[model samples]
Target: MTDWARFLPLSNRDRADDGGVSRDRSPAVASLLSAIAAVLDARPDLLAAPTLRPEVTVDAAVRELLSELGAPWWRRWARGVGALESPRPEVAAFADDALASALHARAAALAGPERRASIHDLRATVVLALELNAAHGAAIVVDPLLCGAVALDLALRSRLPERAVVTARSLVATDGEWRVGRGPELPAPGGAIVLFLAGRADVPPEDSAH
Candidate 1:
């Protein structure tokens, strides 16, 4: 399974309709990605946390991730954000079904066909990056230290007031206290999701078969 937490923070602060463009290399995004990568490289079991840490708020973590990776497209797009985003038909044409589904989901939520499409494309790109990392035999782990209970609480309350409290109660009860790192092995279910913010998932085909 892939880590979804690392990428969760990158959700645009402003919906595309409101002229919110997400930076691809913000310090916040970079930091979060770095933290994830560091933990993955050392241990592959920390992905299972009761809740993320206080400092691991979705936006802050995503900005940190953008900073760590050299990719500046997100930053560029965010700065030039207008009613429309750049067209990426070729990208859309190339994505697979799972990726396409996710991309379509984001596109439908935002405004501006191009911007919406771009959001979907970017999600696929992130997924591909994780695939490459896994193929390389890189140890994958989640940062148990980053707690997200508070942020999740706020998000649930704001987005789904009716279900937020109930959902939060369930997650908090099922998951224990969030911690620092994981042991040698992760404690998640088989095929659990890993929190991957960003990395080089688009590796060359030839290079992938190491």
Candidate 2:
């Protein structure tokens, strides 16, 4: 078993000595990336549709990362690579070549210090790719327990939005070691909760509160 506790605190951890990722978290990060690559490689059609975000499809997001990682601020602003007006299915070759190009050019590291461009972009992309794959009913190699735990940890540390008519509920995981918020009991699987938070409308009712 991977010593997941190494990612504890989830907020202050991943302090890599080289400003990329810590030695421990590096392999985890790489594995996550490889998993994403493998999925997209096998089923390039997964890139055919838009994600929940209409303007931000998987292809557009990947394009954005390619342009922005390690680029000058003006270059990033100039490209505005995300959010195409009419997103369409990119060729499989584009996906393969683009990913390889990113690996060669983008100087991002594995996890994060909350500031490295690549890590930030790549981490979010990894989650996105995996989520998209799962949304399409594909089997993922990563453990659900780990995904939920990390998602919950990240959610807790994020700033809460204001002007909600109802208070936030305390989510108690029926299948993992995580809980967040503080209202009624929102019992659900960890991965399900993460999906719902990402605005995934397809989350099954069984994955929601009882």
Candidate 3:
């Protein structure tokens, strides 16, 4: 079983690395979503309508649900800081990861060969998920768990906006960092710019040469 204790809320005894994340990441993700919307806006002819924000609130709500399913470790710690209940933490973590990973894999498969760009979209989506998860400090489980959560999040969030159609790849963090490559632009015609972002995995062997 995967060692879920690493991500089980306040399981981190260090306290310093406990259930916390970078303050800037939320806005960064919001900006990327906004950027995608902006690009879609520029190509009125391609889409049937203007771009809109994805209903990511729903996904966030789900995460909230997960948090509430039982008292999160952080919450418990904040209250009094006691020992964990130890309810098959490894199994739960493994199950969550498996489900999330499958979701992303299916998404990639659905991209279809007609649009190579969809692959790129998938890449971006995956990268965004990893980055967000890492920033939130939720990536304490295994790759499967991290990948799965990210995939499910993207699938739920992509429902809104222009439905421009996107896909993502497996996010592997190299050197103790999240590594990713943004895919090509949407298949929007015209001389529109195709933008993609790449990142490193959140593993070991840190790449200090930026």
Clash counts for all predictions: 37, 1, 28
Candidate ranking (TM-score, best to worst): 2, 1, 3
lDDT tens per residue, model 2, 127-154: 5655665556545564544455445444
Please say which candidate is ahead in TM-score: 1 or 2. Answer: 2
Error of 2 at 7 (Å): 15
| Model 1 agreement with the true structure over 1-210: per-residue lDDT tens digits | 323242232232234442542332122222333434444345433222211333333222223222222325664455346422322333324323223233333333334333322222333223322332444333433222122322232222233442332232222211323211212222221111222112211111221222
Query: Please, what is the TM-score per model?
Result: 0.24, 0.56, 0.22
Residues 100-126 of candidate 3 have per-residue lDDT tens digits of 343333334334443222222333443
Predictions in order: lDDT: 0.29, 0.48, 0.30
- Which 10 successive residues of model 1 have the least lDDT summed? 189-198
The positional error of residue 93 in candidate 3, measured at the CA in angstroms, is 39
Query: Which run of 10 residues does model 2 get worst, by summed lDDT?
Result: 158-167
In angstroms, the error of model 2 at 170 is 1.8
